[model samples]
Every structure is written in structure tokens, then in C-alpha cells.
Target: MTLVQRELVEFQDVLTPRAISQFLGTEAWALHSRRSFMETWVHDSGVGRSLEYVHIPTDRDAPDFSRRLQETASTLSRVYAISMGELAERVSAIRADLFFVRIARDSADGTIPLRQASGLIDSIEKMMKAAAIVTANPLAKGTGRTSERVRNFLDDDLRMGHTKRGSFIITIAARLHDDDIGHGADDPGAPEREGPAAANRVTRREGRADEPTIDFSRRVMTTLSRSLAVTRRHLDHSDDFVEFEEARESGMTAPIVEAIEEIATDSGGARVDMRFSWTSALPHEGLSEEPVIFTPTAIERAPRVIERFARSAGVPANTDVVGPVIGLSRDTRAAGEEEGDVIIQADVRGSVKKVGVTLSGNDYNWAIYAHRHRLPFTVSGILGKKSGRWWLLDDVEVDASFLIARQHDRIERLGGDAPEDPAAPVDV
Candidate 1:
């Protein structure tokens, strides 16, 4: 068997002459000259400053096309005080929200353990999914089916860029829609315009729309930032998760905390820094321009927080939940005793979530029967979460009456009587 590795994307391959010209045009560069196969763009700083010129190849098929493109990129990098890779990314994702994650470790080299490297990528993806879910549905607990909008955004709009040197750096880009672009200031770093004129304009704009429009991309990042900030503060100051619970509206969920823990643990307790770079093309407001650093203490406390959040988001105690028996697991037990775990596809709140319940003796037998019959099972218990799963404790029993009624409903929905022969066992 042979393994083929994915080819890395290089700046020289992506940063073509046309991309350079478009980027330069946005930076106020003016066309200086044109030749048979090339064009010159000049950026003049007025007065005493020397004019900076970049040569762009008009013909990509020309022999010196690649060379001219590299030269143009180098000159632009120098002019912008950024690396060629950074310039290339800026040009490529002009309308995207950029996130940079750097994993710090004791190792001198930039390489990470193979296990941790895989974990890092998986964790980053989970973090983005959490953010996107919460942003679109503010009250989402992330225990249910994800919306199609979020799934589409993750599949189509989000992108992972090439990794860079210096401990391990991951770059993520989330492309913004055109309507999402016009909300923020053109200059991200510039101070908000002041005085009565700006104030009156803001007032007039506020009057135009009863509710301010939400930028999905910006909202996702903002929610993530707020939730992370809350987590860090909670770790720094208190042990109680009351404040953390309040942050649910800010996109703090079990998955987000778990993702942070994965990154922190993979880095071997070293700090992890996450930086945000909002596109200048659509400069967003209210996002923390400052980087969020996951300190050792915060990382250490993350597991506890994740547990608390999951438990908090779980179904309330002493409640009766009815759902189909989806799975059953039995292990060796003492003589004359029947003990096993049964998984119920219960509806929690408005979402269907799997609830794990342990039953013994008659209850266990009944669960097996329910599983065999493909019938909905009803159980009354306290629902809690552990190890990222929902568990039911105490009073775990099948409601015979509710089960019968649900089975009847299923048969009715089928528009006929169930066959006399037992239905084939459902694959859990």
C-alpha cells in the first residue's frame, strides 16, 4: 500500500499578477506604466517619501511570468511590513474573517507529537462548529441536530489554510457574504468617528432598522470571544459555575470547553494563544482585537467547567422522557442479576438526544424487550451528563402504558396493523 500526501499551497502559486494588481489597487496604488507584457503600479506617499513601484506581468503565459509575480509579492510584502505569506492570505481572503491559533510548547522545534497534531486539528474544527451553531441559534445547547445553515457554512464558507513555522500555527478563514461586509468600518484599527455629526448619523441609521442586522461570520467570532473571555475570567477568579452558566447565551457550551481542553492538553499544559484578524475589507466592531491566551490554570480548570456546563444544559431531574430504545449493552454480572446500559433516543427540550440509563433485574429485561420490539420506552429519572454524554440516574424504568400508546401511534402512522411476525430487529 502507498500513501499520498496532499501538496501544500504556496504563495508563489496563488498570488498571481491579477491578484497583485487588485490588491494594490485597493491600497491606493496607481498605474504608472504599461509595456508589451507587463504593467507597473506605483504607490506614492506624497511629499518627500520615495515612490514604491511593483511590476505585474500582464501575460501569465509569458516566460518570466512566475518570476515577475514573485518579485511583485516580495515588493508588496516589504511595503506592507508583512511576510509574503501574510500578504498572499490578505489578498486571497479579502472578505473573510481570519483566525490564527498558535500552540506553545516546551519543544524547541516547531513540530508537535503526531497524536497531538491530529487532536489540534479536530479540536479547532469542533470549536468552529460550536461557534457557528451558537451564533445562528443563541440558545443552542449543541446536543441536538445541527441546522442546515450552519452545516452549509462550515462546509462551504470555512477554510483551513497552510500551517506555518514557530511552535504550531493554524490559520482559519471564514468567508463573509456581501451583505455582511458593509456593516463595519473600512479601517479596523481606526477610532470611531466622533462629534454631533457622527452621533446624528448613528441615530438616523438606528431609526432605519428596528433591529440591527446580524453578520453571521462576525457574530460567530464575537460569541466565541465572549465565551472564551468568560471562561478565562471564571478560572481566574471563582470556582462556582454560575457565571459560566450565564455565559450560555454567549456561546459557551460543553464542546467549546472540551475543544479548549484538547488543545491545552495536546500542548502538554503549555499556553495556547488565539488571535483574530478581521478583514480590512469588512472591518468588524466589538470583537476583541487582543489575543486570547489559555493559561495553565484555565486549562487545568477546563474539564470541571465542561462537566458543569454539560450538566447544566442537560434535561432536568425527576422528569419522564419517552423515546425509542436505540441500544442495549450487557456485560458479565453476578448470578441471578441482570444489569446493563440502555440508550434511549429521548427528546430533551426540542432536540432529540441520546440518554444513557442503567437498569437491573426486571427493568433490564424490559429494556431488552423494548429494544426487540422497536418500541418507544418511557423512563423517569434525573438526567445529567458525564464524559460528554447524557446519563439518567435513579428510577430508570419502562413505562408500560406510555410504551403501548406509542406503539399504537406508530402502527396507526403505518396505515395498517403490524404484521403478526416480529419486526426485524432495528440496527441501533
Candidate 2:
């Protein structure tokens, strides 16, 4: 079956709160009265501020609390199971959206963890692992739902804005699938079809099949690498010089230029070219916000730069600049020099810097900074440098001393020698 089909089946097995309570050997009445396990405990704000009291009611007719707890646990478990199933589907989907049957069979045979699936994605896997580590210790059965604990668990490990309980359950499911597939028994086929003799044969086959096949995680990594390579090539050859002479410019060119320069500096002084245009108009009333115009020229080239940087840094590609009719900009500045643009600034954690883009009339500018390097950058330009005098700046210079010092410090920290840059021809 296809991954989607498998997902549909798994989704149907989602358990209800009553079922969860029964599984946990708890009364349904107590579970429902406390808002589904989240309101059972409170955090003290004073010194030694930890969870003070855990309210796991015993023999009480806390129908509301019982129902709540059952609901919460059931919701959490069901969500997690569905998420794991989806992640498995995603991995198979990466092979072919309809390859879930093979993928599931392979997974059951110990080929790969469900977390390695494309549906789970890297971000989801990371979140699942983190959640697994935090929630491994099962809370006391009657401790009610500890929302704060759950929230903290999600916050410390998961990406922001993805902390819903359902989301958390999905993450947990992926982790469970990973663990189960890693150490669980292989499917023994239909019992009636196999019988005792067939079972013996299956066991013998499993022992012989102990050797691992193509590592699913590695395959995923390889697939991502190849996809990124193709994306990089497209970005490199994209038509980045097109212009929109007829549209009303929202004045974002300057900010876009600044973003390019910033990207170059962050990229260790690489070379880059930037182009920006409005994709739509800003709303004058409650009708809708003006949609800044995005030219085709900018859209094609943006993803190449983004994918290149993401691959080099071992990060996920940003999706904002990957689509058409979006105000797009491309950057290929020299490594370290890319940091001079607002769009490519690095944080203390070495994450990409983000900045807000503002449009005014036929021009625009960006306000962004690199937290780690403490470097600030900006972009500004007009709609048409020739007719409307709109020209985009694709490159910028960085403080050479700062770059050298930073490079040296990084090398020293890593106990390694500074690497030399290879000489290459400039295309522009």
C-alpha cells in the first residue's frame, strides 16, 4: 500500500480516552474532571520551585477529572501513534508516494526506523528524539496531567510553534517506531497460513536475515543530498536578471540587496547576486494586505543559494523562497562576506539570521543582524535602476580583520588548521 494508504489505516486505530484509562488501570471518572491531565499539578514560583503536589485521586468519583485524564492520555497516545505512522509513510513516500507497503514491510523486517521516513523529516525526528529523552520516565500513574512539564518538555527540544499535544504525540510515535523496529520481532506472517511448522521456518529465516539491508536513514540522507544538488544547479542557472517594469514597486529592492550581502558574508566570503521585485500589491483597506510582487527571475535563483548554504551547514532548506510569485532574492556572496547581508546572518547557535522586510513606494530595505558574529547588514534598492533607477547589490565587503580573527578562533577551538580557499573564476 502507498504511504498515504497506510497512514489512513493507522489513523483509524487511534484510541479513545476511555480506552486509554482502561489500559492504564485508572478510573475514567477521575481522569475527566481535571481538564485532561494538564491541570492536575501546579508549579511553585518560590525557591526550589518545582512541581509541588501531584494530584492522582484514588477511589474518588472525580468523573470530570477521570474523563479529562483518559481523554488527554488517549489523545496523546493516538496522536503519537498516527505521527509515527505518518513518518514511516513519509520515508516510503520519498521512494514513491505509493511505496508504503514495501516500506512498511522493510521497516517490519528491520530495514529502517519510521523516524527515517520522509513524512517524519529531519526536524520531526529531532523533535521525537528529544521528546523521548525527556518523557522516558513515566509519571506516577495518578499524578494528573502535568501541562507545565509537558510544555517544558516540548519547548526545550522541539521547534517553536509545534508544541500541540497532538504534535507531541506524533513525535513520540516516531520515536517509538524507531525503537520498536530497531529491537522488535519481525512479522511471522499469517498464523493460520504458517502453522507451527511454518512458524519454525519463519524463525529460521529471521535468524538468517539478521544482516541489515540498505540503511533507511542513510538512504534518506543520500536522497536529500541528491535533491539538494539538483536544486543547487537550478539556482545557479536561474534567470536572475529579469525585471518587472510595469508593476508598482513597493520599495523592497534595498532590503533585498542588503539580504544578499548578508548572505554572502555568512557564507564565508562567497560571491552573490541579488534581485527583488513585488509580487502583489498592499491592501488599501480591510480587503487584504497588499501582496508584494515576486518576479520569476528571482524565484528560480533563490532556492539554489538557500539549498547550497543549508547543505553545507547540514540544515533544512528554507521554504519561503522556494516557490513562485513570491518576492524572491538570490545571494552568492563570498564566504564570510555573505554575513554582510541581512538575510544570511548567523546566530550564536550558528543558525541562519532572520530579518523583517519593509516596502515603501518603489523601494524596500531589511533590518537584520548576525547574533553570533555581531554583524549587522541591510539592503535597499529601486524598482528599475535604468528607467526607475532600481539596481540590486549582490555583493558586499566585510571587515577582513574580523573575518580572519573569527576564522582563527574557530580553528583554534576545534584544534585544527585553518583551511585555504580554492581559486575560481568569477562569472559576473
Candidate 3:
């Protein structure tokens, strides 16, 4: 496809979300009248933050400097640049902490736990700063620039009022069919705008019960949580960029975001309705390029990876597949003391293989997690031709040892005793 032709083909096509929807087999990843709450403060980091890098002779750094620095050391809008999204993904892949969350919102029925949603605003802030440092330092070298201060909002700073005030309607759309980009047809969600009817817009299948339904707000929050966790893991465990290439397969090249809906805030915070659509198709690399790195700690503990499969009932070695993890089986200790297992929706190339693996009864710490309710993972190993299933055998890296970073330096995990909103749903 020619450059102009490709752009034209991609035009108005809400591709990625649709691709995501399609990948998810949903009608649309859409939410309606969902509320979003954010407290914005006039911190140097939060206020007037720019992806555009400029030279002060004294400084040059961007967590997500999206600019190519081709001519006159110019810059580009993060909304337009893929690098910022990539930077965000890289940080998220590590699943590090960017916020000290405070539980705030939930559904009246208590089904939607906004409190469970990972704090994203804080992640964005942290990543932006991190990107600044990474782009400049290259090797995790500390920037001696005193002009920068840790992104902090507490005590006396909170004493000063910083409340964002406003109300607006939003429509987030996605269309996937490989026309050009996950770039779905242009709708109001394209660029942040204002108005009333604008307050309410509609996609083809607006609120069709049969179309598809997903708790998008919760999904967003979950994504934020997972991203934070990955960052925390990477920062605490691995050394440098080695993690990126360690895995053989990657969806990192997939087009995740065509654009970003930059949140609006001047006062410490703002609340708005967040609507989502779970269409039929979306992209492979999530909506954000920030990847979720899966380092299998379970493999190290497994007694026999390939040999176990060899002994299984008519198992075939080296079957490649990519799909979501369905469920994790635990001991009858949890169920009825049944043997442990891991269920997977194994898409072997194009074939749909619903497979399950007997677990080692251990590996829980590094074994299971749900990405959007279904864990999307990839592995190449044995598949029983008869039973059509296999166990998670060993770590991907056969020889390399892994290390975990010191725990003291981590952003504290939200403890059970931590303060939660009194207004939040009751513990059921």
C-alpha cells in the first residue's frame, strides 16, 4: 500500500478497538454513562507536561519523547507519536508502581469495583517522568538536573485546594477488519471535544444487549493495575532492556493505539462519564504499546517439562499456540482437593484447541493472572493428540537464572489494612 493510500484507507476507520473486539469476539468494547474521577494538582510534572523535547543546552529528556529530532530538533504531539505509547508500554511491561491509590468509586450493585481499578493518572505521571529520564540517561543513569523534583502530592500540598471542575460526554470507538489501521472511522472520541448532543453520541450498535457488554471502566482499571504490577516486577527483578528480547514471540509490533484521549485537568481532579464499545475487532498489541512481559517463574520449579509431556497419554511435542488462559486449577484445598490444572483456549495457529494442563500444585506466585478476564499468553510445547492438552513444563529460558529486586524500594503494595473509601461498596 502506498503511503497516501494507506492513510486514506486508515481514515475514519476505528481499527484497533475493533481488532481488539474481534480478537475478543465481542460486539464492541463500549461503556456508557460510566463515571471517571481524577484529582489534578498543579504540580510541575502534571502541569504543562509536554512530549515535545526542547534543548536548554542544560537539558534534554523525555519519558516519551515522540519526536524524531530530524530537523531543528523538532517535536511531535504524543497524541500523534507512537513512541510515547511504546514508552508507556515498556514501563507498563515492567508493571511498576506509579501511584499510591485511594479507593474511591463503585457501582451501586457493587458489581463494578472502580476501587479495584489501578490508578492510571498516577502511572501516566510516573511514566512521563521515567520516559524523560530513560530517553536521556539511556542506561538508567541518574539525571543530576535539580530542576526536576519527585512527583509528590501530600500534606501541605493537599492543604492547598486543587479541584478540577467540568462535565462532558465522551464516545470511544473501534473498528477492526484490516483496512489500514486499527484506526476506526472518526467519531467524537477522535479528539477530546465539548458540547451536549456531543455529550451523547452513538455507534451503530449503541446499547444492544445482544451485541456485547463489558465493564470497560473496570477493564481500564485492570489494565492500569496489571501495567503497574508488570512495571513493579521488572524494576524489582530484571536489569535493563534484556527483558524485551528475552521472549521469542511478541505482539509488541502490533498497532495498539491510533491516538490517545489526553485527560483534562488543572485543579487536582476531575470526573467525567467514560463510555466504551466492545466491537468485533481490535489490535494485537493492546490499546497501549506498553507490553505485559510474562517471565515464567513456574518453569524453574517444574520437575520435568518435556519428559512430563512425553509420558502423558499420546502427547505430541512442540505444538505452537497463542490464546487466552481460561482458568487455574488448585488443590481440593481450594476446591475439593482436586489435582491442580491450568485451562487454556489454545489457538494453535488457526485451530481452536481448548486445552488444560495438570499443575505442579506450586507455581502460584508466577503462574496465573487474568488480562481482561482472560489471560492472553503464548507457548510452544506438547499437545496430547487424544486428550488435547498439556502442562506448563518449564521456564522459557533453559539456562538463565532470574533475580528479584529488593522489596524495600518498591512502591508499597496496597495492603488489606490500607484505608479505603468509606463510601465504597461494603465487603461482601
Best by TM-score: 1
Clashes of each: 0, 91, 67
| RMSD (CA, Å), each prediction | 9.3, 24.3, 25.0
What TM-score goes with each of the models? 0.61, 0.19, 0.19
Q: Which portions of model 3 show Cα errors greater than 4 Å?
A: 10-12, 15-215, 218-224, 227-292, 296-428
Q: Which scores higher on lDDT, 1 or 3?
A: 1
Give the least accurate 10-residue stretch of model 3, judged by summed lDDT.
252-261
Per-residue lDDT for 1-428 in model 3, tens only? 54333432332121222221112112211222211121111112234663322221111233222121211111211323443223222212111112222212333442222321222333233323333333333343112231232222111111111111122221111111122112211122332322222212222346683443322222333343333333324322555322322311211100010001112111122222221222212222333324333222321211232233234324354565456666666666666323466556654322233555554322232235322234354545555422212344433211101101111112135333422532111121
Candidate 1 pairs with clashing backbones: none
lDDT of 3 at 200: 23
lDDT of 2: 0.27
In candidate 2, position 251 carries an lDDT of 17
What lDDT would each prediction earn against the true structure? Answer: 0.66, 0.27, 0.27
Candidate 1 C-alpha lDDT tens digits along 1-428: 11111111255444755445545544667666656577777887678989988787766568877666667776777788987666778775555667888987766777788867876877787778777887777777654567898888889888887676777888888876644332112222322332222211211235567544555776776777777777666665556444665666555677777677767765777898888877654445666768887788867777678657646656355767788888788857646677788888766543345678887766676677687877677787876554445678676655666445555576679786664532321111
The TM-score of predicted model 3 comes to: 0.19
Candidate 1 regions exceeding 4 Å error are: 1-9, 25-28, 31-40, 177-215, 238-242, 315-428
